[model samples]
Target chain A: MILIGEDLNVMSGEISRVIKEREPGPIQQCVAAQTKNGMDYLDVNVGPVKKDPEGTMEWLINTVQEVTDLPLCLDTTNPLAMEAGLKFCKSKALLNSASGATESMETMLPLAAKYSADVVLSVINDAGLPSDADERAASIMESAAVANELGIANENIWVDPVLLPIGVDQRQVTSYLEFIQMLQDLLPGAKSTCGLSNLSYGAPKELKSLLNRTFLVMIGRYGQHSAIVSGFDRELIRLIRGEVPEMVELIYRAMDEENMDISALPQKELEYVKTVQVLMGKSLYSHSWLEV
Target chain B: MMKYEPPLEKISVNIRETVVGHGEKALKIGGENTLPFHFFEGSLPNPPGLALEILDTEPENWAPSVLEPFEDVVSDPVKWAKKCVEVFGAEMLCLRLLSADPMGKNGSAEEAAEITKIVADAVDVPLIVWGTDMEEKDAQVLTQVARACSGKNLLLAPLVKGNYEEIAKAAMEHGHAIVAQASMDANLTKELNIALCKFFPPEKIVIDPTASALGYGLEYTFSIIEEIKQFGLADKDKMMQMPILCDFGGDCWRTKEAKENREQGILWEAITGITFILAGANLLILRHPEALKLIKEMVV
Candidate 1:
C-alpha cells in the first residue's frame, strides 16, 4: 500500500499550532516520525483554510519539504490553497481531491493538469454522495472525463468512492467496496485510495483501530491502490506490508465464507473474523460487536 | 501527412530502488516506473547495471573463446576480480564460489570466505557472491562469506527456497543485500519474495528468474520477466516489485554453438543480455568483456 500519513493535518491541535506559529520544529518532527514509520507520502491537510489560505498553504509546503522528500498529498477544499501548495511542491504532489461537482471540476482539475500532479477524484456530484456502487461509478466516470479533457491521463487520477462512517450508514460501506472492485474495469489505468479512518468516525476510540485495519484488508483485497492512514499505527503498517499472513488469511476465509470451526481460532484471529463479518454486514455492527 | 501519437500508459508503482556496495561508487538500480527503455512513458532513474563473472577456482570445461580474456588471472580469484574492474571496466563483479560445491572441489566454508574477502578488498566496485547450486553447501558458504565481508554490502546470490533463511538472516545482520533465485516461474518468484520479505527488507532483495541461453528457453524466461514486471507495476503486487537480475553467462557459454565458435559465442551472450534488458532486467551477469561492451553500448 502507498501509505499517505494522516498525522500532518490542521485538524490536530499540535499540527494547527505549528502551522499558525510558523514553527518548523513540530512540523519537521511529525515529518520525520511519519517517514520513519514507513509512510510513502505525507498528507499536508490545512482544512478549508478560510483565512489566508494561500499564505498558509505556501508556508506549510515549504516547511514540510525542508525536512523530507516524500511526496505530499495537498488536502484542502479551497482551490486557491491547493494551487498554492502545488506550486511550492519540490516533488510530485497529489491534489487531495477534485469531484464530479462542477465547481471542483472547473477549478481543481486544471490546477492538477497545469502542475502535472496526480489527483484524487472523489465520487461525488451536485446531488451529493451517491446512493450505490453504480451511481458512484457514474460520478467518477464524469469527473474522469473532465480530467481527460484538461489533458490529465487516467493513470494520474486516483478515484476515491467517499467512504462514509459505517456506524452511520452500513450500506454505503458495501457500496464503496463494490465501487473499488469496479474501478479497474471502469477506468483501466486509474488508481484507488480512501480516507481509511472515515469508516470508524462514529465508533468508540477503542474499536476505531480494529475497524480501520479490517476495512483496509477488505479494500486491499479488492485491489485498492493506496489509503490515507494513521502513521503511528505499527500493526496497521505491518498488515499493509503483508507481514501478518495468518491475520490476512483469516480475513480472506471470512470473506469467502469458508467453513471453519470458529472455536479453533485464537482470540486475536476470532476478533478479526468478527470484524470482517461486521464490515461485510453478515453480522450487525455495534460497539459490542467484538464481545458478541 | 498525419501525425501519430503513441498510446502510452504510465505505471503507478515504481520498482523499489536497491543499493549495493557503499559510499561513492555504490550502484543503485530498479527505480523505473515504466517498461525498460520506455522513456516516452516514465523515468528510468538508473540504467541496467552490468557485472562480469569470475570463479573462485580455475574454471573447468570452459569455452576457449570466453576463457581467452581472463586466462592469465584465472588461477588467482583476487587478480581476476581486479582485472574485471581495472582492465575490463566492469562496474560490478559476481564471484561464483564453484570450489565450494560438495560435488566438486568440496572447499571449506572458511576457504571460500577468505578468498571472497581478498577479492572484495581487491576491487572498488560492488561484488555479488554467488554460491554453488548445492543448497546445504551454499547455506554454509554464503553465510560465512556474508559475515567475513561484514558491512561491505556485497549482494549474496541464488538464495533459493531451501537455503534462503540462514543466508538471508546473515545478509541482514551483516548489512548485505540478497538475490532470490527462482526457476523461470512467476508464481515461484513471487512466493520466494513473499517468504523472504517476512524476515528481510524487500528493498534489499533482487529477483533472478533463472535466465537461459538465446535458443534455450529464453522466450520462456522473457515471458516470466514480463509477467513479474506487470504484476509489480500494473497490479501493484508488492512481492513482485524488486529489481530483476539475470546471470546467463554460464548458460550462454556452455551451449553447443557458443562452445565451438568465438564470434557466435559473443553475439549469443550479447544478444541474450540485450533481450533480458528489453524484458526488464535491471542487472546482468555476462562472462566476456566484448559481450559486456556490446550490451553497454546498446544500453547507453
Candidate 2:
C-alpha cells in the first residue's frame, strides 16, 4: 500500500503559476498530505512539458526537491528534462523509463545502470501499442531484454503495460488485465501500478463509478502493489489507513481462498546451457547455478 | 486501396446440426474464406437465421417494444413458443429463462424441465435455452433444460469458469450444442473457446462474443468479435474458429431505441439490424417482423 504521488505537469491548472510563484507551502502541503496518506515516494513529473521549454522544469524540480526529502520519480516526457531533474535529485530516485525502443535503449538506460536507480519501463516500443496481451508481452520481454543487455539488474526494472482509458475503448480492459497478468508472470518481483480513475472517463453516469471501483478490485488482485487513486476520497483512505493489519488479509484473501493456481501460464523459456564432459553430457554451462 | 494479406487466416468452420425447426433450413454456421457475412468471397452455405426471444416468466425489466409482441404468452412457456413461431413467423426460438434469475422467483429444476418439454412439444422449432446469466443457478437450471430437450438438438449457452463442468456433461448427454459466451473480451472469448474444445467438438460449439447495440457500447463489442473472428480464421485456431452468433436483436431491442416509440419504431429497429449486420453477427434474436424484413433485404 505504498503510495507514489503523481504530479504530471500538463495537469494541475496552476502549474505555470507554481513555476512563477515558486511557492513551497502548497507543494510542501501536497507532499505532506501524500506522506501522511502513506506515500513512500513523491513522483515529480514535468510531463508533456514542451511548451515553455527553458528553465521552467529546473525550477519545479529544484523547488519540489527542496520541499520533500522523500524520493522522487523524476518523471518527464522530455529526455533533457529527465536528465536535468535527475542530475539535481538528492536521493537514489526512480527513473520513469527506458523502453524496448532502440532510441530509449541508447538514451535513458545507461543513466539507470550508472545511477543504480530503479527504472519503470513501459511495455511499449517502436512496435507500437499492442492491441492484445500476447503482443504486449512481446514488447515487455523486449524491454526486459534491453535492460538486461545494459547490465541493469533484474530487480531494478519495473514494466508498466500502459494503462489505456476504457472510455476510449472498452475492449481494452481485458487487454489491460492480460497485460498486467503477463507483467506479473514475467517480472515476478517488481512494482506494478496504473492510474485508477481512467476507466470511467466517458462511460455512462451509472456505470462510471461502479466500473472504476470494480476495475480497482480486479487489478488489485493481479499483483498491483501500488496505485494512483482519487486523493479526495478521504473516508476510503482512512479506511485503507486504519486497517493496516488487515492489508495482507484483504489482498491475499482470494489467493488464500483459491490458492490461485497459475497453471494457465505457459512454461518459462529454458535457459541455454552447454554441459562439461565430466557431467556425462556435453553441456557447457555458464551461470547454470544462478548466483544469488 | 487497402490491399492486405491475412496470415493464419481462418479457412472455414462448420457448426452442424443446429436444427432451426421442422420445415426451416438447417442452421449450418460456417464459411471458408471470410468473416461472417463476407458473401462476396466466402461460400456461406447456410444463410444466417433469426430467433424470436421468449421467456418462461415475465421479465421484470424489458424494453416495452420487446414485451409488446409477446405480452399475452408470458404466463405459459408452450403458448409463448407457439405464439413466437406461429404469429411471429420466428424461424427459431431463443427461450431466455427469466425464472432462473437468482433475483427472480427462482424456478426449480423440475419446473424448468417441464417448461422446456412443453415448449419443445408445442412448437417443433429448435430451442436455444439460455440461463438467467447467474453462474450457480444457471448451472442448475440449464442442466435440467438440456436434459428435457435431449436429442432434440437444442443449444444451451455459456458454460464459464463456474458452470462449464455441469453444462458440458448435460450438453453431451442431451446431444445439445454449447454456446461459448465471452463478456466483451476477445482474449476471454479465445480462452472460453479453448475450454469448450476440451470436451466438445468444433461442430457442436457456437460462440457468443456478447453483442450490444451500436451506440450503447456496440463498437467495443464489435471489435472483440472481429478479433475473435480474426483469431479463428487467421490464426487457424481450431477452437477459436467456432462460428460466432451475436444476440444483438436481443441486445438492440433492450436498449433505448427500441423503447423510444414516437412513431419511429420501424426506423429505430432498422438502425439496430443494420448496425449489428455490419458488426459481424451470424445469428440474431429479434421481435419486430418489420425489422427482420429490413435486415433480410439488406443481407440479400
Q: Best candidate per TM-score, number?
A: 2
Instruction: Give the alpha carbon lDDT tens digit for every residue of A197-282 in model 2.
Output: 66556544543433444455556666666655554445335434554434324334432334433344222201101011101111
Task: Predict model 2's lDDT versus the native.
Answer: 0.64
Residue B186 lDDT in model 1?
A: 69
lDDT of each: 0.90, 0.64
Specify the poorest-scoring 10-residue window by lDDT in model 1 chain B. Answer: B185-194
lDDT by residue (B145-181, candidate 1, tens digit) is: 9999999999998899899999999999999999999
Q: A130-175 in candidate 1: lDDT tens per residue?
A: 9999999888888899999999999999998999887766679888
Interface RMSD of each: 16.0, 17.7
Clash count for candidate 2 is: 10
Of candidate 2 chain B, the 10-residue stretch with the lowest lDDT total is B14-23
Clashing pairs in 1: none
